[model samples]
Target: MLNHSAGIRPQTRQRVLDAITELGYRPNQAARALVTSRSQVIGVLVATRAAAYGVQKMVYEIEDAAGDAGYRVAIATCLSDDVSVRDAVDRLVAQAVEALVVVGPQAGVFNRLTAHPLAIPFVMVASDRHDDLSVSFDQVEGARIATRHLIELGHTRILHLAGPVGWVEADARMRGYLAELADHGLAPRPVIRCEWTADSGYRAACEVLGTTDVTAVFCSNDQTALGLLHALHESGRRVPQDVSVIGFDDVPDSAHYRPPLTTIRQDFAVAGQRAVGMLLAQLRAAPPPPADPVRPRLVVRDSTAPPG
Candidate 1:
């Protein structure tokens, strides 16, 4: 093919490409980064998996998007709060990440960001408890959908398995749940506070099972729903036949759960994509319009039905 140079030598071009592949030689992103000062890496700072569901999902999605966009994802977790987040950002900076995306920093994290000088662009995945983000999900609306679904099914004594006491987003979601109930002219039923864990859900469900005959339960997250399902079954209550259950986050295992849980599906992957897109726009010194809030869709399966 190299010898056959006529007709623009298509075979020769293929041979050259094959040779490049065989040699394991590739263009250096670093060279382009150094020349343009755009590292082509998106940094993702996230809380531990136990602390934040959305962020965990978002981080993985951001990595996927970055890969598709021809960039890399540099991540740090267990940055429990703002101080740790700042430190993590410094670390990613060392790795030459051109932009940043943070998830679930404690209070003052967003506030502090305003005063901090950033050498590169950054996007916060969720911080509305303190301040509205550059962009994110329509959390309130999602809760509204969850609540409305219950009400439409004639569930008036709807119960809420609220998230841990100080999470702002949790508070917002709870409020939406309550507001939606009140709007239907129904009194707010019992709310069981639980940590974001399957065990917590189990304990909370046991508590609820002991007294209230809640026709329906809205778990704060999927893990809790898993726990609740167990407690309900043990108490001689059949799902959908006795009490309907619903959950948020639609985690990967939700669909595979016993009886196949019904949950609110938020495409954190899409959210992650938006975060990196915003960061890239910032890195390029280009205007990044606000990312449209992601909509949550209720994925109904074996868990929910008319109260029997």
Candidate 2:
């Protein structure tokens, strides 16, 4: 046991340090927890159907940041089902994590967590704003930028292949799409909601491509855009010449798509860092001031052009 109040001689401290280093000694976590009443662990809760590139990237950053802060991360992945999030929370609480960084969709989770009020500090990355403990990228603005890009290229009959309902990002993107269309005085087009997968996008695109009066389509994410591209190719349509497409989440592969994909880029790394910083602040009893959201930017590529 090391005592800070009764100072030790410099030589004694060095000897202990040298002996520990030579012995390759490691601290026993159980003993340390008994002394400090802390687990030195941060719990991470992830609940999503589409654990896409952005979510993966963000989780990596969060783990990195937490490690740098002298804390280990305990991850719990939950399904999109009703009771899974609560179960996930229960598991994390059982581990006695000092804080939590929740990523992915947590629709009803806020209420459940609030009602229970786990005394530990937590930061959630999702659609709902939680006073100051929530952090999120601006999905609505990202969608607006994607849609405005198509409109700038003179695409009138634009269709939005949206993400499934009950997702906050999906709702925000849908609202942004509708807002942009309304701003242009264009009648609202019926949105086709699909899972955030290439297969779902392919199926949706195949069903709507030939029948609709659409010359442009804005997909919710890059995977969906990839599927749409494949569908368009099979349907005897030339990208940018006959149809224009835009996507969200400018994923790594988006730039390498056949004609390349025009999409919105969200800085998942920055968002994760910010969320971790906030959680750290909460743990340290100091909350950071409200900051601007991580905004998404549009990257134009060969996939989009003026409708022929």
lDDT of 2 by residue, 59-124 (tens): 999999999999888999987564887899889989889998888564666665667777888888
Residue pairs of candidate 2 with colliding backbone atoms: none
| Candidate 1 per-residue lDDT over residues 1-308, each given as its tens digit | 33345676676688887998899977787887888777778787774445556667777888987888888888876545657667877888898987778776343456666577787777777656322235566767778888888889888888999887656556767988988988889988767899888999999888778788678888888999999999988898999888899989889889988779988888888877777777767656777756677778989999888888
For each candidate, give its TM-score against the true structure: 0.84, 0.92
Model 1 weakest lDDT span, ten residues long: 127-136
Give RMSD (Å) of candidate 2 vs. truth: 2.1
Residue 201 accuracy (lDDT) in model 2: 95
Clashing pairs in 1: none
